[model samples]
Target: MSPQTDDVALSTTAERKVVVQSAGAQPDKDWVIVTRGLKREYDMGGEIVRALQGVDLAIRKNEYVAIMGPSGSGKSTLMNLIGCLDTPNGGEYWLSGQLVSTMKDDELARVRNKEIGFVFQTFNLLPRATALHNVELPLVYAGVGSAERKERAMEALTKVQLGDRAMHRPNELSGGQRQRVAIARALVNRPAILLADEPTGNLDSTTSEEIMRVFETLANTGQTVIMVTHEPDIAAHARRVVVLRDGKIASDERNQKVTSSLGL
Candidate 1:
């Protein structure tokens, strides 16, 4: 695949994202994400289902964090809120110091397109689109011009070492390669946070490790990453782990930084 082709691919609307990172964008400053008294509820046949109840979280810029919990524990709901895919029934959410919860639909959509990049459990690439086009989807929606958009997209693909497979479609690639392409798509927009939900759910152990390595490289480059996974092995790759239970934070702890500590 030519680098030029990789750069010009179309946009894929995964979750919402907005661009909050700039050189003067508080490089060393902490706190890229913050939430207070967060809550989300749903009505089912006139019954209330509380997905999250009074959750509070603070994440710093460039931090690698993971949210872990069993099904029905609100992990996915929290991820959606964080990813800006959905709004909460009650609470405050701040992204790069902007109040996301208070924004209207158009404002929220802009924030999501520019500030956050999302990776799904299924990869979510368009079946008919080539890998490069899939990665370029976000840039297209942001009103980026063709030439510049292609350049940025290609750069992102290169970051994940997928520059050579830009022309291949999802069906033509292996599971690991497909996920790598998805990761490239997530990074293409250079969002403030790369939000991933069960990114390794469909991959085998070796492939999963390969995917995590891409994440590690991203973190090393000062990318803020927040991933949701239930597997302990996958969570171990994160710098810190936060466990949710019964719609609340059960435990939050710093995992060993083996990557940085051992220079892996």
Candidate 2:
């Protein structure tokens, strides 16, 4: 697939309008994820630590974006909010046309299950389960039947080119293979977005490139992937990079030269 760019310019005015819009209104279909004036704070030792301070972001469907920043730049907080793992104290978060920021915990949990697929740095697979079984876990949680779950899991594994290792456990797989299995598990549910947090953090340089190629393939296939990483080289794998600083967006730009998996 040919490389693409995020043509939507950053408009604070538009973001503010989306923020002030009446709650429960569906976002425009073009935007798969939107955050307006998103804010989050933590109480630390009787002092308040403002992690995210009114962040406004918009991501369209099939966008391969990287959220990058130094430590304490609020990228992690932004990721948590985007992933629906945490809610912003202020502002509206819309995911796949739904206003998810206002959702309750249980509702958010359901939304996470139905709308988001997560790949963590640790490759959080069940140590005892085979790659196929690990991939099947999400469908199981969704109450899918046995046969269909297995079939979908296998197909997802096949997408990552790990079909032959479906029966292998995490302990039996290499670091890259385990991450691929995790990616397969994330894709099994066909979620609206694949959210990866420091996906290649645990791998060596060679293995990291291997995992990156899998992500590259997924992005080429129209997957909306948002990866949170501090490493510039890893972030370069994404077509667009958004850098956060001092709890706000410092820079958002397209990478003119996206890195290829083949190291061209």
Candidate 3:
């Protein structure tokens, strides 16, 4: 099926409900991610902070989704949970058909390494490492051989149109180039979901659009992407937008205008 068809199929409220309901049964491969009644809370000096309250989110394979919210709206918390950086205090999280919310630290680490590719707002490339080396870091952690890692890293850099800059260090590149390297690093792992948190936050408007175009291409080519951002314009690039308020989902809608504008 075409990417456009997939986008429309997943946008319907009925389809979303089906995916969410399937989360409790045997996992469906079509649903790349599912969170059922997910909840998170924290205690600070005897005061409780509820970061997430029963958030039910289902993202299908090849979906391009943006999770948006204002400050203190729990978008960051939800991103953490989805990325396996943090586990929920209650409820379930299934990624690639595996229940991961209750996984141990080491198990979580393994799942994170295998299932999620994360791009951060700060462009978290190693300062001293070359772009190629930075992109190879995840493969190194996975115990891939040096030659294979190098090959895959080079391929990822080429995907981002940074093949010629493989030897360049982060400091040697412009902000846009650095973010491209970070994106290459994220994609090098061939993860199930590309989870980007404020990926273009540090860049100027022009650079942000450049990165969004890269994301758009990836999504069009059947990559599953979940982005967390507060900027409406940035979020608009996604095919679907889910807004959060007071630790709950306020609205979920298809961005038909943005979708058509991007030719997705």
Candidate 4:
């Protein structure tokens, strides 16, 4: 797995595993995400497919990390685990201090709704709903009052620079504006982490760059973001890049260019 050229700031393997190696205990509050020997598998008929093989990772609060890999490299599986959308077959996962790898499906659902904000390639907006309504859906599901939901939804829209388009339907917005709305919706809950899966996959190059700038702004403002992308150019926008190969991490290093640009 070749990442775009750069000098790695992490000089030793030990440094990379410092937090990951702390097994059998709750991770420090300094780490917003941690995985100790994380593993996931699926059964295809009678055959077993191991998607993740003892993956150990640590991400602190406010860190912007990009996960990169080939199609079968298990990045998606790892994302699902980190997002609490799926439980692993083996090992421990801690997100915002909760050990979620052992949580039941119902419990996992609750944590996922409260802790992970997801932005997808498809935007996933309701075609008939206004941008404000789409952003309000999460709060609505959380049983928030209409007044409060509207206020928070507007705030989220403003964060993504979409407040002026709040009343517009998805069809009334450009591709970039729609994605911005999706980003606004994801931020409405102020989740512990924002997990984006190929967020630029559907957009043109210019629009993708626009969205990446939004992510950069959010990360600079202390929001933790985890983006899974295949393109090196896209991953380069992140301050750190983690490349996965054959279900394991092949390299995890800082992207000096982006890190320096962000002054992080």
Q: What lDDT does candidate 2 reach at residue 83?
A: 91
- What lDDT, from 0 to 1, does candidate 3 have? 0.91
lDDT of 4 by residue, 1-264 (tens): 012212232223565488788787888776788899999999999999999999999887777899999999999999989988889999999999889999998898778778888899999999999999999998887789999999999999998888899999999999999999999988898898999999999999999999999998887677889999999999998878999998999998878787576444
lDDT of 1 at 28: 23
lDDT of 2 by residue, 71-113 (tens): 9999989999999999889988999988889889989988888
lDDT of model 3, residue 113: 79
Measured on C-alpha atoms, candidate 1 has an lDDT of: 0.81
Cα shift from native, residue 184, model 4 (Å): 0.6
Mind giving the per-residue lDDT tens digits that candidate 1 earns over 21-91?
Answer: 22123322356777777899989999999999977777777778899999999999999899888899997
Scanning candidate 3 in windows of ten residues, the lowest lDDT window is 1-10
Selected candidate, larger TM-score, 3 vs 4: 3
TM-score of each: 0.86, 0.90, 0.95, 0.92
Candidate structures ordered by lDDT, highest first: 3, 4, 2, 1
lDDT of 2: 0.87
